[model samples]
Target chain A: MVMSCRDRVLAAINQETLDRPPVAVFTTCDTIGMMKASGASWPEAHSDPQKMATLGCAQADYFGLESVRAGFCLTEEAEALGCPIDMGTSHSSPMLKGHRNKYDPMKKIYDEPNDLPDIDVFLNTKRVKTTIEAMKIMKKTHGEKYCVVGGNTGPFTLCGHLLNTENLVYSVWTDPKEAQKWVAAIAPYCKAFGQALLDAGADIVQMSEPSASTDILAPSDFPIQSGQFVKHALGDLTGHTILHICGDSAPIIPFMFDTGVTGISVEEKVPPEKAVKIANKRGALVGNVGCAMPLYKGTPQEVAKAARASRDAGFNVISAGCGVPIGTPDDNIRALVKAITG
Target chain B: MNDKKLLKELADSVVACDPNRARIASEEALKEGIDPVEAINKGLVIGMGVIGNDYAEHKIYLPQVLVAAHSMYEGLNVLLPAIPKGDLSDAKTAITAVVQGDVHDIGKNIVKTMLTAGGYIVNDLGKDVTPSSIANTAKETSVNVVCLSTLMTPTMDSMQEAVKLINDNGYHKNCIITIGGPPTSEKFAKEIGADHRDDDAQSCVKYVNSKMKKEVK
Candidate 1:
């Protein structure tokens, strides 16, 4: 019997043999062509659950992407947390406006350990509600056939946005106990948010924690700061959980597995030989494809070649290294999908 | 304290990321009539060198590096005023900013701080900076390099636009454009007409050092 898209993705995440390897993208599926075709433009699409759902569904319904991912921008969680946001253009993700914590304190955003924004406020925000609605719509329309992937700001990245990135880093050094407390406070929210995504009908929840990557943070700090928070935040997911971090994560791959996620999504910078070997011992390996050069700028043939190479090397599921860029050619995305399905 | 011991203390304070210690060391050096150039070179810069290497090697991470930079800044605010105005003539002047449509600045901040530690006179334009402003700043400051950073792929075009504005404004003749960030690459840099693209702040500093022959005061 032919496996459904949902089965294919679940099988891949569970490391089961597939009719063929499943192709998935853990990043945003929004593209200019996708937006134009689905009649879902950003700024509006970012706010309107209907438009956002259309853009996400177009991934599976339109481009043959196995997983339809939503929450196009990373700023949604920050917006809910009280950061002023600029919903970017049709081609861009929304970004946090001026530094929110620059007003009252110099050393930190929250003067006291308990001063962090209430988790209830974040859950009730319009953006979060819209995202939940979008996930529901995707699950309703395509969940039976395709995997509906939902995510929000992971703790480290969200903290980076809340307190200025520099201030957060400084506080982590100057007052580690306080920093840990702040992160601990955010952990429950992270769990609640991920649970909300799953409750909204997502089969897999991706904790996109790029800030915790080895590229940006010290490898030593990963297990302590980001690793601990991620473990606390998404450890109890009823559905499969995928942890996606940007940049060369070879050094921290083992630590990522220790977080107890079902799968790990790494970018092209990590050597496939290493990722495959390490992932075999830990969990399912999702990606090692270049998102920019081959997947976005290179021809379909190049993308297919890249995908085939990743699959041949033991990557259970083929995926883009990072979020698919806005202007990435439709054929490039199709090349990835076709490489697996065909 | 002897000049050597005092300078070592200054360097140690920064490596420890101790602002109060750094400030106190700077004051002691000033009271001892130690030359400001020696204090910055033998003390502040030396400490940053260690921090930079630790960061590059992953022996230390963002928090340590950021706090160390802050400590250096605390020391420099005391020592810099004492340096003779003309002593920095050979130092290259550079401007750094996160490109328009992108609010990410941690990479840009690291580059700016590292460049300063490398003895460059860096003017940070902060985040969400416009291409016109980048070009205008280059023209106004007569800088040797303009460093742009963007983590968002959508803002990659803004890097190209900034390069175009710099070239159109004729600042390209004097100012070399460099782009850094996750999505930026050598191909993207060349495609955008940028002169160079470095993987990190340290590499950018080395690139600028080789090109400008920055005097290590």
Candidate 2:
């Protein structure tokens, strides 16, 4: 009845033999209610390596999440890139409002990347450094046990977060070539970022691109600007590469596979069968869990039902389709683990 | 310029979301002395209404809706200014949010904007809205309708809970409560006694029109 949660998840990751598909209890901050119930705290994880690893391990121990992602958002990189975050109620990641405000459409757009942002995010920032150190610590704590996943905003997504998609979409249409230049810059950064994660002992490197999803851009738009750079980033990435995009990504999913993403994680809006078809034709299918279901209001039993559906649907890893919502219930976390294990 | 073909063309412009074309279309209708209301009702409003439906059905996305609504508004801008604003008794008022225990704000924001451009005055109760707060807003704002949203299935019960409170408070008497989001459906709304259910922002306008016309029992 009891086996190592880490092994179950890693087996799925390796695409090896498995009793049941591994379910990742997505590590978005637990809901206020659940946090209060578990008596858990944050800022400790954000600031301390040991506490952060403890936080990461706690989710796995409690819920049987096969994989543990950094849980930090892309705003971390944007913040280093000179964007100030609103520090909204919960971990408000910074946004690049300044550059976006007077963005000129006709001018040559460049990702305008520099090593400075990377240095700050990876070495200087207390929170950033602490996050990396935590991964190292979690590696020591559970590395031999489970797969530690690392996430970063895809370059295009980071750019969207910077310039705001309101204008970003316009730029995509008007200055397509300039946009490519901007996207190209992020590829090296993404590659570097992924490398940093792998070096930190992450078994999986998750890179989500909000800009490439069909919900955002058409398939016709993929080949030129966004998809090419992603292909570049994917080629250089070590370990398993996961491409996470929001919404129904059925149309552009094939292109995602063409880039050789080791796996694809999608939201509930995207049918699991579609992803399964794609995965069957290509690589591993990671998820399509309703972020709100287990992470918000659903009980352990409901989580089990959802997991059973995922198992039936052929999802290799049970993961929320999107980032876990803030304040998700702990029992629900227990339920998510139960779903994967039971 | 007030050609019917031109007006229809203008309406199509709204659907394509080209405000300049929409403006040209609206001006032609007015110059031809078309009944401003009829021009709006038949030309721009009806077309944009379709986009909202398309959005609900996932036939169209947020960007398309934004463009279509923007086009409709440009047409409205041409007409609203030209004609002495008459009482368009068809105005709808909606209170929307992501519901409590949820923090997603984009879907609610897009839907609200579309509804507002559709001539519905919307009060965004903001993300993570509690049921009691939603009920209170309905009571206090004299809102014509309550629109509850949640992108998560777990928070869906919150929508049901909000709808129940509205009924319990007798706020459902004349007011139509509409709910939609990633997990919501028309059928789900009916199961919970919600007066209206739309998964997309566009269809709600038509539903709103139907509700406004219904006689109070």
Q: Return the top candidate by TM-score.
A: 1
- DockQ of each model against the real complex? 0.67, 0.19
Instruction: Kindly list the per-residue Cα lDDT of model 1 for residues B1-217, writing each as its tens digit.
Output: 9999999999999999888899999999999999988899899999998998888766888888888898899999999999888888867789999998888888999999999999889999998898999999999988988899998777887888999999999878776778999888998888879988988788888887787644212
At residue B40, give the lDDT of candidate 1: 90
lDDT per model, in order? 0.83, 0.67
lDDT of 2 by residue, A225-312 (tens): 5778877786457677888877777777777777777877777776777678766646667776677654465577876677677778
Give lDDT: candidate 1, residue A118: 73
* Alpha-carbon shift of residue A151 in model 1 (angstroms): 1.4
Error of 1 at A176 (Å): 1.6
TM-score of chain A of each: 0.95, 0.86
For the predicted complex of model 1, DockQ is 0.67
Candidate 2 clashes between residue pairs 3 or more apart in a chain or in different chains: A30-A327, A31-A327, A31-A328, A32-A327, A85-A94, A111-A182, B2-B28, B52-B202, B56-B200
- In candidate 1, stretches whose alpha carbon ends up further than 4 angstroms from where it belongs are A99-110, A113-120, B86-90, B214-217
* Least well predicted 10-residue stretch by lDDT in candidate 1 chain A: A100-109
